[model samples]
Target: MPTLTRLLSIIGLIVTGAVLSMYLLVSYVEPEPREIIVEIQKEGFE
Candidate 1:
């Protein structure tokens, strides 16, 4: 029972750490802006 409890606690801590790190990355990171262009065939415009 003690081993099972320890294992669950370790797993919970690892999951919590992962979630916190992901939250930090999402909150702090930024993406570059860019312009995009597309070409269409003349037939498609008809």
Candidate 2:
């Protein structure tokens, strides 16, 4: 029972490390905002 617990703990640690690394890598990505221009023609188009 003790051995199984230890093995599970090790796996959990590895998964946690992978998740942390992925989060850190994605934090560097910068998303640019886009500008949308709407043109309004004659008042009859309403």
Candidate 3:
């Protein structure tokens, strides 16, 4: 049916846009480096 084909096309377009945006973000962004420290209680090992 025409309706089913239209719905599939819309969904495909949305998915394509999402993937393109994510690829751009991944390819162009840089993350800052930071040190993290955590303290654990010794009693938890028992």
Candidate 4:
């Protein structure tokens, strides 16, 4: 039916808009990485 088609089209447009906005937002934002250090203890001599 025409109503079903219209609903799908609206949903598709909304999804597309949301995806584009998120892409732009993320592209402009920079993420900082945290540095992690790990140490291991040896009980026996090698």
Q: Which candidate is the best by lDDT?
A: 1
User: Candidate 2 vs candidate 4: which has greater TM-score?
Assistant: 4
The lDDT for every candidate, in the order shown, is 0.66, 0.64, 0.65, 0.64
lDDT of 2 at 15: 100
By TM-score, the candidates rank as 1, 4, 3, 2
TM-score of 1: 0.62
| Model 2, global lDDT | 0.64
lDDT per residue for candidate 1 within 1-46, as digits (tens), equals 9999999999999999999987666556633211111123444666
Residue 8 accuracy (lDDT) in model 3: 100
The pairs that clash in candidate 1 are none
Candidate 3 ranges with C-alpha deviation above 4 Å: 31-46
TM-score per candidate, chains pooled: 0.62, 0.59, 0.61, 0.62
**How many residue pairs clash in each candidate at the backbone level?**
0, 0, 0, 0
lDDT-better candidate, 1 vs 4: 1
Q: Looking at model 4, which ten-residue stretch has the lowest summed lDDT?
A: 32-41
Per-residue lDDT for 1-46 in model 2, tens only?
9999999999999999999886666554523212111223333366
